[model samples]
Target chain A: MPPAHPPVDTADVFALLERGRALSTPVLRAAVGRLAPPMDTVAAYHFGWIDAEGRPADGDGGKAVRPALSLLSAEAAGSAPETGVPGAVAVELVHNFSLLHDDLMDGDEQRRHRDTVWKVHGPAQAILVGDALFALANEVLLEIGTVEAGRAARRLTTASRKLIDGQAQDISFEHRERVTVEECLEMEGNKTGALLACAVSIGAVLGGADDRTADILESYGHHLGLAFQAVDDLLGIWGDPEATGKQTWSDLRQRKKSLPVVAALAAGGPASEQLAELLAADAKSNDFDSFSEEEFATRAALIDEAGGREWTSQEARRQHTVAIEALSRVDMPEHVRAQLTALADFVVVRKR
Target chain B: MPPAHPPVDTADVFALLERGRALSTPVLRAAVGRLAPPMDTVAAYHFGWIDAEGRPADGDGGKAVRPALSLLSAEAAGSAPETGVPGAVAVELVHNFSLLHDDLMDGDEQRRHRDTVWKVHGPAQAILVGDALFALANEVLLEIGTVEAGRAARRLTTASRKLIDGQAQDISFEHRERVTVEECLEMEGNKTGALLACAVSIGAVLGGADDRTADILESYGHHLGLAFQAVDDLLGIWGDPEATGKQTWSDLRQRKKSLPVVAALAAGGPASEQLAELLAADAKSNDFDSFSEEEFATRAALIDEAGGREWTSQEARRQHTVAIEALSRVDMPEHVRAQLTALADFVVVRKR
Candidate 1:
């Protein structure tokens, strides 16, 4: 059987990223100066322009994946990409704001292989800094400068709440002994799917797409988010640490109640019972390194027996199929739709 | 001179307070269920109706001052008092969100003589609860169900950023040796004045008042905030803790660079050396209690000699004049205008 993938031109994605930054950097630059000067350092860090010190560091570090999706969806829905640049940037700013706060909440000290904002700046400064970004996102929406712009702000605001709601649910599951796959999906819908859906909807709204086209694009984004997260869960355990840049079995160590763990737990049997005991023991232990490699192999075998990996991979493909169906539902320009569909497949099937 | 005090119609103000609560409480109740169920106790405590254990506590705390002002402003602008209830509640929710995060940032463990949300729930939970409130505020604005109703959300988002910016400046000021009154005012304008201005503007916007009327109400609110802070500065040193419920001379012990302190520092006299030395003393030591008292007396004398107190007082009166002038600029019913003018006077000259 052949791998089912769409035609993605990496060149198009790279070009959109460059052009999107050129259009949006000015807004961020102008707003950063107006921000409380004390937070300028952290804000700069968030943009990946500077390190904790006042000196400049890297140029730009984020994937810009969310904003690109927004801009591309707008273009595919028949609007110029430039028209939705502000919304694209606004969506990304909101995304980064949540990332900064999430890092603090989750107690992760490193992000992008450097000290996270809170670790360098302290929780007080980091919280306020994240708040400033949120405000800036709202301000950017106002810069949309039209009636439809107000409508767009309203939609983004709703998405913001859903994102937080998802985060809250994810945190709640940490202590729970039982969690269903349906409940897990709902949580991800808020945490991962809502913003992706918003990205496409905002882009289409700002792009002047009709309501039907925008709805179709929204559905596409929603399924794409689910597919992305499913693949992400698969990679959490199976992918190489060197390739993924994540600590080996870090999710298991954290007892994160991730999708795969929940699925494995739901498929109860002797293997599941053993996995549960290991988790309980791991939760009580301070030394994670002591957990033997053989133990990990056993756990991996158990996960396979429960069809955890296969289930998630299959679910990822299913979501992508739905995304393609959503794409077909809209009257998108053929080339743009093809590119977007290809991007969707790449997200689900990529190894890392 | 006979003090030109605004008439205090306590009954009217209290009624508006009840109306504001009636509108806002339900929104919170509805949203609370969606947060982490385990963390809902923390959220409830922050609202002041329940303890950290989720049991009923004391009566509603915090005077609901801003919300009352909002509803009253709408009434004073010739709309029915109930007309502004939705917006009044929205502003209050935003205010509470800031207060929660501010308490965390300030490291204040006590609020209204009870443990802060962070103290009982931990920082991570507190952060999410505050975020939930922020999201809920935006949701409430949308629930108001008018295109113009969203104007309040926009103003709130703007003010929320300004408040954070002002706070950023405040945090930075602690590290600096000298800060000018202009800089202080600019910071206060964002931190303190912005929200009050929004609170007042929201009222007029909800009342269906024109832009000019909203601007006038905003001016009234701005002046009221300035005057209120000025009086609060005075009370920080001289007011009885029994009446005010704040620690006596707490601001002095903290060596805060408030308006009066900045005014005295800028005077440039022989006493300036002693003032600087006292401020230079460690803020976290028990010696702060003794050193602060003597220095406070000396600084108060210097402030009087340098005309600092007089200048601040005169500024307050001037702003009050401007607020009244704004009221006259707008076309409203005579009784309503008088009521708002009275409210303006009450803000600057309140005794406790």
Candidate 2:
């Protein structure tokens, strides 16, 4: 089949994301600032805007990718980007809320080259701040005072519920010795896809789009999220630490059951059998702290030899194509459509 | 001045609460049932409705006092109790969310004569379930689908944020050697008062009350919460473990800076000095696990001798009076006003 549309360039994606970030950052900060002190200070530090002492810092906040999607999705629904700021802020707050709590649950100490909130502050404060931000997200959506505010709140809540469910499943997965690829994908769909779908559809809802357009945007976001997670799984195993800001082979060292690892385990080849033996031996020894760098590298090579890496990469491309098809379902303005396509491409193709 | 109103009978209070619970319990269950398992199982266990094995069990969920207040407030605004079901459920869900997370943070193994969610499951599931419940609360409110739904969400969010803030402050207070009475009261107001006020006002808003009436109901709830917390502080120090489902003198054993303790520390009397010396010695010893029953008894006696017990009782009564006066500011039907009055009296006078 001939190409349905020209591929989106990386430069266009960055420029569009930069524009969305500029508009959404101030609104997000103001919403977070509405929380009382200590919590506000903790949230600021988590956002990479300030140090623990409340002084301005040089660290970067996250890419603001979710909010950018909200803004672009809003524009795609034929509304001004400003009209989507509330939805953008809501999604961003929820995203950070999950991040703060997830770090505590996983016992992670760092993120984006900064100490995690639970590390700088105590776990109790991190939990409370995550809650405050979650509540603040609902408050901001209601304050929008539009006719669609009620619907927006409902949508956000639905997404949040799924997000929590996904987290629960992910935590449970860590204890299980074997997990199917289907189960892993379902978990990712809830964990990542739900919020991203909310981010995409919320803008359309706020813009008063028809149900057909909103559904199409949500579909685009769901497939994009799956592709994003697949690519993230690949990066967890093989990407350069400098580009990803994560320790080399960090996932393998932690014995994480990522997509590729699970796929390799399920493949039933000789490499897969050997990989299982190695993992089982590691579990029995329980000496994760003394795991050498070479052992981590060997696990990565094993996953590749079992064809898990190739399968995951192919799955990412498949999902990316489906995401583009979903975007094509909605006849948005050419520029807006192109930006959405570019963002989806960036999600699957990014180095970080 | 003479008493502004007749004293409320406790029987009447329970009757009113029974009616509200009968009306609201089914709705609350249905809302919680919407969650996916094991979240549903965890929530059910947290609510004391079931065992960890998912079988029916004999356990009390709670007093259902907040839901009763919500329903009564709705009736005060000339609406049926059914109209307040959403608000009641929302309040109850948020209450459980706080309880689940607080139990994890405080490391309390028991609540309501049963294992806490964290103890029964684990901290990760407890945290995830709390997040799920919080989201469900918002979902319930938005599903009300009235013009007031937006306003209700905003009100609920505000109360939830303060509740989280109060929890954060309470955690921070545990590390401080001294906390002022003023700070203690402020924290109580945020922690307990905010949710009670929301419970009182949300019904009025749902019933389409004017701002004045809603504010009066909120004020009543605020004072009632303070009075309730004061009574709880007394119970923490002196109540029977059989009644409170907590260890005898639990707060003192943990060196909690509750309202009465803070007030005593600020009194500057000989008894205060003695109490301070005892507490300082305990801190220096740093042997909490081996703290004897005699030590706990002695600490309680010192606090009472310092006038903390008497002062707290007087403060509770004063707050009860203020709460009644706030209720008088609104003119509702005679029966509804009496129910509200009776509930307030029950709150202040309860032994548990």
Candidate 3:
């Protein structure tokens, strides 16, 4: 028999994000509003709700992808979206917390086309604000006053620890000569996958979903996170400068050891050998700025010729497929399933 | 009528600390063990469980005062001391997390007579390990899976936010010329009082105490924390370097705007004006290294002559009395209250 409601064709991805922002922004704002003084001001600036001078400025906050997943996961558990607001706000807070700290640690000057918090304020404010937001996430979750909230809080905290572990691994990789594809994946899984997976399942846990169902949703989100990263790595190297708001060959210029570079090196081709030597020499040099556009282009071309680009493309598709397959195991409403699937598709193919 | 269990005249402060260490160290170690490597290694080193080379070292950890309070709070709530191990472990983790980050932020080179984590490992590790421990603290609480655990988790996280806020205010105070005594006390309350209050009350919350009892205990902890900080500020300038394991005039050398200094500035006297000028000159100098013992001693003598030393000592005693009075509002074992009182007394009078 046909289902009462057939699955919608792919979800309208932008509409889904708008819906997420609408539902979660109020709760998110109220939570961030609880921060004290300059920390509060710095956080507001980081979120694009205000400018460095503390005046209200409508700037680019993030896409709210994690919040969307959290809200959808509540629907997927046969609960109302509002049931997921705490989890949604918590994941959003944690995501920004990481971003604030990572921007400082990586010495990034700009994000979302504006000066970062650390750049505008100082490194101390960045660290302090990040710590404040992280604490706020736990407070929001545990304040819900349910056993389910306790369970969800535990999940969120554990995932947060894994996220920290992943960041440490990424930082360590920066100084290394080589990182295996396996090690890179593991790091990305911890850094990005863990939080997304938690975001997907925490709402379900809060909505009283059983362990088995939450686990399946987590599996789906974990693969989607990998797919998301793969696409992000592709954009880092090959996306149009206008579209990405980055210089040509941005990752190459920065010597980021992302998926494509790691896979290319691991592939062991003539082009890979040349690419390795070029990279090693570039790394040893003190003045990377001395290199011209041709130098970065050459590195990018070598990486592509070594099958890095194609392998990453295929890996993204494979992970997307796995994510979809995992979603099929849960007995969610057909339309809700469609939204999650569409979100995964969007992540795998987004340009920025 | 005398209670069946007579109030002990006073607690042996060191013996109380040793008992706390015995009860909480195993749980603390186990919680930290869950952290991923390199992070785990860094945290172990920070806790003095291992040396910089990763060899086991029997080194000074800390006083275990927070853990003792946690354990004792459970007993005060009519629960076994074992009921509070999770709270004890969690607070210990939080205290160390603050220390790890503060050391990096303040550029302290040493702690507990050993090189700081950022000194031995790196700034990045110190930040990451601190974050990991903070996350672990929430995990330890929520994983207990009790209704009381949820309540306690909420309290701890709220306290943690205040602690971060306190740190931000403290950092900002560093760059300022003059800070009022009110502002200094508020910052100290947030930085030191909030966490101690959480430590003192969280176990009772977890042991199923009502909000009123917990609130009373928190008041006691808050005042005790202020008293403790006052003693610490005094020791920073006046204690022998061998006793504090710091240079003579340690806070002065760092240009810390601590309570005594603020109070002295607020006291309107000839000595206050002289001390302020010396501090202003010191602040403007690019070469603090050129300042001799005589210079620092002169500054200290001027501060003392301005009545800053006397004011701070009286403030500590006043706070200690308030802390003891708070205990009178809560119904608990007489011996437990006696121990808490004795702990507060020890803190106000401790030589180191």
All candidates: DockQ: 0.55, 0.75, 0.75
Task: Please report the candidate that would top lDDT against the real structure.
Answer: 3
- Report the poorest 10 consecutive residues by lDDT, candidate 1 chain B: B1-10
Using DockQ as the measure, which candidate wins?
3
Q: Per-residue lDDT of B83-202 in model 2, one digit per residue for the tens? A: 788899999999999999998888888888788898889888888889999999998888777778778778889889899989888988888778999899999999999999999988
In angstroms, give how far residue B4 of model 1 lies from its true place.
Answer: 5.3
Docking class of 2: medium
Per-residue alpha-carbon lDDT of candidate 3 for residues A1-352, written as tens digits (9 for 90 to 100): 1112233343498888888899999898899888888777899999999988889999888778999999999999999988888999999999999998887777777777788888999877888888999999998988878889989999999889989989988888888999999999999898889999998998899999999999999999999999888887888899887676666787777677999999999999799999999999988998987889888889999999999998998888888889999998999999999889888877876677
lDDT of each: 0.74, 0.86, 0.88
* Model 3 chain B worst lDDT run, 10 consecutive residues: B1-10
- List model 2 lDDT by residue over A199-273, tens digit each: 998887898887788778888888989988898899888988877777888677666788999999989889999
In candidate 2, position A300 carries an lDDT of 89
Q: What TM-score does the predicted chain A of each candidate obtain versus native chain A? A: 0.90, 0.96, 0.95
Q: Is candidate 2 or candidate 3 better by TM-score?
A: 2
Q: In candidate 2 chain A, what residue range of length 10 has the lowest lDDT sum? A: A1-10
**Model 1: lDDT of residue A68:** 69
Q: Report the C-alpha lDDT of model 1 over B160-232, residue by residue, as the tens digit.
A: 8888888888778767778998987787777778888888888777777777777777887777777777766
